[model samples]
Target: MIRILAFVLTLGMLAACSAPPSSTGDEVQRLASEIRSLGPDIDPVEAERAARIAYSYSAQLAQEYEITDPPLVHNAKVNKGLRPRGLCWHWAEDIERRLDQEGFETLEMHRAIANADNPFRIDHSTAIISRKGETMRDGIVLDPWRYGGVLYWSPLTEDTKYEWVPRDAVLEKRRLDQHGALLPYVSG
Candidate 1:
């Protein structure tokens, strides 16, 4: 009974993923507007270009990654070596790398991690865009992995589902945790 229910749900998800994704013009515009709103100094042209590249490149990645399932399902496939790449960090890294090519003087790209301190949930990574001289907290989250390549973007403070922290901080903490774990406990 459990196996049959799982099969039905998988079929439904597969059917949902079969449809070709639509153009991202409206999404691009909305993202551009949000990017521009990051600060008064943000360049409108750069914002638009970044938004366009983010959405288009994400779609390209979706195809390259052969994303035929939801985010978690695709993650499982990637973990199982059934897919080459589609992980959250892959999305963040690829998007950040692609965006870096533009050399936007008024914009900065940041990487963040969430759920690093939570034992129950997996760590989530994403790229963020902010005005020059600002931190990730003042940036907008550009998350393409949330919906399995469908870009899910929002302002940093407004993204309620995840409490993001700087990527470096999380990595450093993880390193410390591992080092501590490796040390033998001394019962004094």
Candidate 2:
């Protein structure tokens, strides 16, 4: 009886640990696909319209790709090296440009190193969209050719800095120039 109980308990724990995180990725992707399916006459040039289109597209990509966590340097490194084309930045840039051409204002965001002494250095990029009359602001962190939506209100003045990276590390090196490198920096 004790052995069986222990086995069951272990199994339960494993299942809990492996459970999927938030479904934000799927939600984002679904929204994006819906927007893409809209009629061609639909103006993607208006800020409001563009915001809707970009948001939906971004959400769909997130859902389809299963990217739940905020974008990180390590995620970019692993996905870029292992995934097809190994061109994470290219995907991000293309998305941002596309959204912009469709009339949405886009901002390229970089995660600034929080600490001054740390040796490792890296940065990630994303697109921010501004739509009139909509109180909810949306931002996407692109890495691994995937966008992690940081859904919130517009003009994010306080939450712009990401807390995930270890602070105090001096910028040891910039990794963007390296062939096939995913992150902007590779720490020493």
Candidate 3:
């Protein structure tokens, strides 16, 4: 009975962590529409291309990262040197690097860290895309690590689960905090 129960649980987890559905073109179109809504100056062609790349590259990374486990499980594997890479920061970094290659004329990419100020939770890193003149707060979050490589995106303000801060600002505050100066945690 115990063996059967264990097997059932394992199967359930695997099912829950399976690769995202096959109809990714729908996702691409949805993301492109959202990107174009950022501002009037954003080029529709650039938005479409960026959306396509974001989804496709995330799928590519999932295969490269050998992501068969849930996000936290993969993260533990990465920390234990059992896996090469699948962490949130890895996704953010790789996506940002790939997107940067496009040299988008009307769009810009930014990196953000969430839960940096909360000692009880692990920090989450993600890539954000916004109009060239805007900041990360005004961008759309491109997060692939949350569901083991399935792409999840939302307008910054609409991502209710995370309160994101600019990555540089978070790092700088941590630096300052390390210098015997304590900074209060501010939730955005």
Candidate 4:
């Protein structure tokens, strides 16, 4: 009986995720305000456009991967490397590349490293953005990998959920260029 119920619930979620992306960019001013609320001095217009771009990319990826099914759990253990949508890094990397291409004049996006620091635990990856030249700690975490295709965001400094270490863009770029190379300075 429990399995049957879970199956039904999963089917419902699958239906929901197949629906079109929620944001049509029709409410640009409203989205801008929402972005501003997350951080001071952010150009809501740019943020909104960037956000919409990310959302579109995520939605397309989710559809391609058939993750529109949503999932029984948002937990990492369950969501592990499921492919196309697997791994938080995939989402972060994909979105980061897209945003990077668009170019945020006032915003600086950084590869945020979660301070897992434990050998037993793996480091979680995500991307963040801030006013150019502003401290990365005070940036906005754009975690689009979690919660299915839903984007999760929070203040990097006040979140307290994860201690983050940033990599020098130059070295980090070199590290990523290696492809399958270890992330420098990450303890995990």
Candidate 5:
């Protein structure tokens, strides 16, 4: 069942990414509907453009960073330097920057720190979009790096791979810098 769902999502993601950017209400409504399917209150036209920009930039980063299959772990000796830029966080930043430019009227893009409470203190980072001023706990996790460049997104609370709580402590409530680069915890 999970495989089927992933397949469907991948197809939908690729289709949305490939479609040319549009401002038509119909196109916007369609794309917005799909994003909202995962639970977000975004303008469809804005959502369409955001996805297109994310995908396009991901491709560019993949090439520029020399990304390879089985994404490189950030800070790992194998991932150091400009050679293999496959860190999942890199993917997150790429998408974050693209969406930041779109600047949604009804939504705010967040640089979410996932699994901030891990025993090892490691956190996985990703891009999130939610209604303006909503909590990170309420955002949708848009993680393109997890699957080696395939965009994986779902409601943060419902995300299966990691717990995307607001901060290391649920009460901390911190936001990532607009630069969107975490000093550490870039592991996948």
Candidate 6:
């Protein structure tokens, strides 16, 4: 009886551990919807242009492809002729520019060098935008071009380190930020 009970318990634990977290497709769809809703609230002309650009690139990436990173996917579909990894920074810069043109106060930040002792450098950028006070938390969305996903704000102080926000954490942060109406967390 003891052996059987232990086996059953172990099996249950394994099943739980192996289960996948939230689907990326559903999360992306939610973020897309949120962006669309916020579009009308922005300045009309700029909003239209920005929305068109974001939507167009997003759609292109959704087409059949093995790539998953949003920025990379966008670049690949739009510029198929270019070598892989050639347009990472270019796409980020383009997104930053469009967001700025849309009248949303924007900021671009770059990751610091790995270490003085090491020759390697880290290349990543994040965008921050200002929105109505009521929409503060949801204001900052990290569209990691190399990683095709959106991350929302959390209680992430400068000290909290993470390569990427877990999908559940991203969704929770989105809700909390939207609830509190606090500005997006920005790191120097």
For model 3, the stretches where C-alpha displacement exceeds 4 angstroms are 1-25, 181-188
Query: lDDT (0-100) at residue 95 of candidate 1?
Result: 98
Query: Which 10 successive residues of model 6 have the least lDDT summed?
Result: 106-115
Weakest lDDT window of 10 consecutive positions for candidate 1: 15-24
Which candidate wins on TM-score?
1
Per-candidate TM vs. native? 0.85, 0.37, 0.84, 0.61, 0.61, 0.34
Question: Which segments of candidate 4 are over 4 A away from where they belong?
Answer: 1-31, 37-42, 68-82, 167-188
Candidate 4 accuracy as TM-score: 0.61
Worst 10 residues of 4 by lDDT: 68-77
Go through the candidates in order and give the C-alpha RMSD of each one to the true structure. Answer: 3.6, 11.6, 6.5, 8.4, 11.7, 15.5
The per-residue C-alpha lDDT of model 2 at residue 63 equals 57
- Expressed as tens digits, the lDDT of each residue in 18-121 for candidate 2 is 33335554544443433333334323434345546455655565554455443443254446664222233444554556655643332222222332334564
Instruction: Write candidate 5's Cα lDDT for 1-188 as tens digits.
Output: 99978865655564444322333445334435556554455666666666566556766766676555444332242344646555656667777777877767877777766665577545677888777777767767777666556555667877776866543344344444423556666689
What lDDT does each candidate get?
Answer: 0.91, 0.40, 0.91, 0.64, 0.61, 0.41
Question: Distance from true position, residue 20, model 1, in Å?
Answer: 13
Per-residue alpha-carbon lDDT of model 3 for 1-188, expressed as tens digits? 99978866865675476454455558999999999999999999999999999999999999999998888767777998999999999999999999999999999999999999799789999999999989999999999998778899999999998999999999998887787556567799
Q: Over the stretch 22-76, how does candidate 1's per-residue lDDT look in tens digits?
A: 6555889999999999889889999999999999999999999999888777887
Better of 2 and 3 by TM-score: 3
Candidates sorted by TM-score, best first: 1, 3, 5, 4, 2, 6
TM-score for candidate 1: 0.85
Q: Candidate 4 clash total?
A: 0
In model 6, pairs of residues that clash are 69-148, 70-148
Residue 96 shift from truth in candidate 1, angstroms:
0.7
Better of 2 and 3 by lDDT: 3
Please provide, for model 4 over 47-156, each residue's C-alpha lDDT reduced to its tens digit, 9 standing for 90 to 100. Answer: 88876775677777666555644433333334565544546667778778888887777777887766445574456678886777777776777766555776656678
